[model samples]
Target: MKVFFVTLGCKVNQYESEAMQKLFEASGYVRADEISEADVVVVNTCTVTAVSSQKSRQMIRRAAGANQNSIVAVVGCYAQSEPEVVAAIDGVDVVVGTKDRTRIVELVEAAISMRNEELGIRNEQPLSVVGTVDEIRDFEELPHAPQRTRAFLKIEDGCNNFCAYCIIPYVRGRVRSRSLESIRDECLKLKAAGFKEIVLTGIHVGTYGRDLRCQVSGVSGQKISLVDAVKTVLDAANPLRLRLGSLEPVELTDELIELIKTDERICNHVHLPLQSGSDEILKAMHRPYTTKNFAELTARLVDEIPEISIGTDLIVGFPGETDENFAETLEFIQSQPFAKIHVFPYSARAGTVAATLPNQIPSSTKKIRTNSALEISRDKSKIFVERLIGRTVEIIAETSTDGLVDGLTKNYVRVYLPDENIPLGEVVKVRVEKIFHDGVWGDYVD
Candidate 1:
């Protein structure tokens, strides 16, 4: 059988889809380059925003309608949250949520056989494969890494912080961390497979190990922090570089800051999502930290690690955000020494507290505010990359085409260099020559 996959959403989803592909391959299934050519199609969905959910539905319908003979299976966050809706779709043969995807090959086989046996029977009974989302209390560890120079290693899953504007916690359930031994083993495997960098990713990465104890490791019986997880990978795998996903400002404790400052192996880039810069809006959104607290953390990070690139996420038009509040947010973000910013207009997801809140900002206002913040982000990014011109930095070459190679610096700045027969995934030094499109043009050094 041939399998084709359509994946959406965060790095976690990407990693999971890769794992699913491996599962199918292990069962003697081949991969198809296109959905139309496959005997089995998997639609890995994302429901982070209404837009994402809509796109997922569209893909599922298109996959089912495009090829009537293919077995259409829907999985991931959207399926977990709305299995009934997905099942009612015209062509979804099998449906499983976030969990039980490890048994997807078996489920697909069973679903196909059942459908064949009951060809004329009404498709009344839904596929009996849905897994309980909340019952997932243990971390799902998949030791597979997608083929890439940098691999995203999911060390934790789910979230406890249900930010009012987010639907992730509901779909992902509570926090569950991968054990230190599991993480170390995965890292060693990825390193042995020639991955140069490993990115620690999760729903709420900062809260890793908060609910679990170290198991069968040197740190056994002790609670592990995000720092401890990183330390484990550093000691066990010793990859060229280790990167972290977005983190909560409150989780940037003194110990964490000190470790990042002292360790050169850890990438000098941090992305903190400041949903709204206005304290009033933050409270309304149920975000725990204040503008003052966030500002202090950024200040300390810059002071300690001078060359660090600090990125942030900001929402433009949240409910109850008055003109003054927006102005405060705009001013606050501009005042910070952020290397880059990811601007998002508030997307009110159903079941989120902000969805029912009054005083919703208009679409025009959201557009204007989002554009303004994006302009600031562009300026910040330009300033950050410009400063790196003429400096020699270490980077792992990722892609090459037409005699041009592209890679990312340790600070996560994309750098393009003329092809020098440099092998992909090889860590090499490059001296920044000048500012190019969105990044810097560089030449390989030695």
Candidate 2:
């Protein structure tokens, strides 16, 4: 049998899809290059926004229409949040949620068996295996699936914070951290697989180990933390580079900061989501930190790590955001030493508190603010990359084509080398020469 996969949303979702693919491949199934050729089709969904949910639905329908005989399976956050809706969709044979993905292959096999037993007749109801998100406690362990040059190791799952504008907590459940032993094992496997970089990803990465008792060898009963997990990965894998996923500002403790400062293997880049810069809008959105708190944290990081790159997520045209509030946000963003800013127009999800709040911003207004913030982001990115000119930095070559190789720096700068012979997945030092396209052009330092 051949299987095809359609993955959507965050890195976590991508990791899960890869794990599921590994399971299918190991079970004597071939991977299909096209959707129409597969015996089974898996549509991994995302529901971070209403648009994402719509896209998931569209993809499912498209898959179903493309291959009538293929067993169409839907999984991930969108399925977890609305199992009945997904199951009711035509051509869906199996519907599993965010959890219990280790059983994906078995579920698909059962679906295939049922279809054959029914003489190829389509079933009215799909086999759905969604459970309540809140009841989940322990992290589900999935195998390490490395991408081309970098390997993503998920160390944590779920979220405890119920941000007013987020629907993630409803679908992902409370914080459930992976065991320290699991982290070490995965790191060792990635190292043995010759992966040069390992990125520790999670729904709320900074909240890793918050819900778990110590499982490390030396401290069995003590409370574990993300710092401990990082130390474990470093000790076990010793990869050429280690990068962290998106982190909450409030959870970035001083100890973790110190570790990043001292450990050269840890990347000098951090993606901290500052959803909105206006304190009033932030409070309305139920974010934990204030503008003052955010400023202090960024300042401290810059003061200690001079070459660090700090990236942030910003939401513009939030509900009840007056002209003055928007001015404050723009001014705050301008004053910060941000290397890159991901500008998002406020998207009020259906189940989120912000959706029911008064004074919803109009779509036209949101579009205007989004464009303005994007302009600032372009300027900030240009300035950040220009500063690295003439400096030598290491990048693991991720792509090579047409006599050019491209990779990202420890500080998150994309550097391009005009050499096709450079092996992909090998970390090479290059001195920045000039600004090229979206990144900087560099010459091999060796």
Candidate 3:
């Protein structure tokens, strides 16, 4: 069987798609180059935001249109939350939620077996089930990276954070992590596969290893924190660098920060989420970290790792955000000046705590705040890139554009090098020429 997989949203979704791809490949399936030629198209959907959910719907219709006779299976968080809405689409034959990745594979087979004329079109079958989706054990299998450049090892699943704004914990269930052995084995395999980097991904990475503690000794066993996980991968010394996914601000500790300084292989970039810089607004949104604590930690990290690229996620116009609070947030961001900012206007989902909160900001206000934050982010990013000018740095070459190849530095800055001689997965040194709007332009030094 030939199959195409479309993934949206978080790195965790991408990791799960890799897992699904492995399942099909193990079942003797060949990956399709395009949706039109595939026997099945499995869309690993994301619903982190309203925009991502809409994008998922767009991909489903696009996939269905491309292959009218092919089996269309939609799975992942968006499907888990609104399977009914996805099922209503014209061409989706199977809609699986967060729980049934294995079942989704079976459904794809069933869908392929059905005749095109017999397939339902007008209305989608209902699949709006909640809570844990997997009835059986999680497959212990580790999925290798689809590309040779990088690998995503999902150490944990689900979230217990219950932030008033996020729909993930509700859709994906409470936190569940893979066993220490399983995580190590996958990292080792990816390193053996010639991958240059392995990103440890999850819904909530900070809360990793808590669930698996009961499985072994140490009585509240230090089964391994995310830091320990990174250390394990580093110990393997497969010549692969370690990069972490988006992390909650509260997760940054002395040990984790120290690891970044001590481990030469760990990337010098950390995505710390500061949803709001106003404590009152944070309380209204039910985020655990206070503005004061977040700011102090931010300063502390910068103090320790002077060259670290600190990126962050910020929400504008959250519920009950007063004028003073918004100003305070703007002031806070200006003071910190993050390397990258993921700015989002608040979208109230159905069952989230902040959805029903009073004093929601107007759309116009949200737009204004978003623009302001973006402008600052762009400036900060440019400054960081500019600082690298004339400095020779090592980077992982990934793609080429306009006769120049581009790759990311250890700090995760994309740099363009004037060389076709560089292979796709090899790390090479390049001297910075100039910083572009998107990335740095440079010449290959060695």
Please report the candidate that would top TM-score against the real structure.
2
Which regions of candidate 2 are displaced past 4 Å?
214-221, 401-403
TM-score of each: 0.95, 0.96, 0.93
Cα lDDT of model 3 by residue, 173-275, tens digit: 8777777677777767776778887777888989887677666455555455777667767776355588888888888878999988887778889999898
lDDT string for model 2 (51-113, tens) is 899999999999999899999999999999889999999999999998989999999988988
lDDT of each: 0.87, 0.90, 0.80
Alpha carbon lDDT at 15, candidate 3: 77
Give the backbone clash total of model 2: 0
What local lDDT score does residue 193 receive in model 1, on the 0 to 100 scale?
87
Ranking by lDDT: 2, 1, 3
- For every model shown, the clashing-pair count is 0, 0, 3
Candidates by TM-score, descending order: 2, 1, 3
Number of clashes in model 3? 3
Alpha carbon lDDT at 121, candidate 3: 40
State, as a TM-score between 0 and 1, how close model 3 is to the true structure. Answer: 0.93
